[model samples]
Target: MLLMHSQVKAKTPPTGLMSNTEQDQQFQVLVEQHKGILYKVAKTYCQDESERQDLIQEIMIQLWQAFPRYNPQYKISTWVYRIAINVAISFFRKYQRRKSSVDLSDPPMYITEPENVEKEAQLQLLEQFIHELRDIDKALMLLYLEDRSQAEIAEILGLSLSNVSTKVGRIKEQLKRRFSNHKI
Candidate 1:
């Protein structure tokens, strides 16, 4: 969670200034469309319900603030990802500055219906292991889970293509090692 970083360009900048009704409608639509993406990404970043809720709210507020500045040069999904990841990363830093390591022994306080609830136990263990990872590795895994191609991930992360591939490979090996050696 130590990445020292860092959106789709809005198709229109609403030059004339949108009325409250139109702005509210657009905000509602965007929230409805992107909420799941934000949740899944946020869930991967934080292990606790409180942190997840706070992070998502911060991300949404940032997104709303950023709307006016969005350039119309890229996909909206890309822009949203940028904001989501940035928010998560910042939250991680803030948490670390306050308390560096999270204690997993605190109990499973935040259990949503996972894609594979049958494997929730394993998923929780894996989540803890992944949380122990370096910040760049966490970022890479998030992009991978989002199904970003290596090239696309590289672009978003500003990494060389080979660097992305190599780092991902190493992270996989690290995950495998941790899983096998894990006590849980």
Candidate 2:
């Protein structure tokens, strides 16, 4: 159960027309609908369960704060993705810096059930490959794997469409190499 009930509520309603209750209700509904985005972004950036929870909380707080300025012209998912990815990247960097100073042994947050051991191993290897990527490339791969359009990814990550396409191709080749090396 992802903690969607954030303690941080918008201090003021977006339009100042709706009561706080109404605003909270509306925000809750939207967050609930888009909760999967939060989960995936958090999972991508955080390997430890506690760290993932902290990242999710930070993302939720950011989303709450930015809710007022959310443009209606953009899809909600796009906006959510933008904010969540940014927050996750920041969190990951901070965590990395702290980790560099302290040699903490982090454990995997979750493991696949033994339904198919080969598939599980492949998934774990893919996740390990993803974690090996640089921050921006990691974000790009996440969006690409989610099947987000290159244009949408460009918009979210503030990169040109051509840049996104090129980087995605490069990242795919890198992943393929890593997998092949492991296979042999």
Best by TM-score: 2
TM-score of 1: 0.73
Q: Write the per-residue lDDT of candidate 2 for residues 92-171, one digit (tens) a residue.
A: 44444322221223346455567667777888899989988998999999999999999999998999999999999999
lDDT of each: 0.69, 0.76
Give lDDT tens digits, candidate 1, residues 1-184.
Answer: 1111112223554224667666656665666677776887677777777666667777777888887676556556667778888788774444533321322223454556676564777777777777887766887887886688898788778899999999989888888888778755
How many clashing pairs does model 2 include? 0
Candidate 2: residue 1 lDDT (0-100) = 17
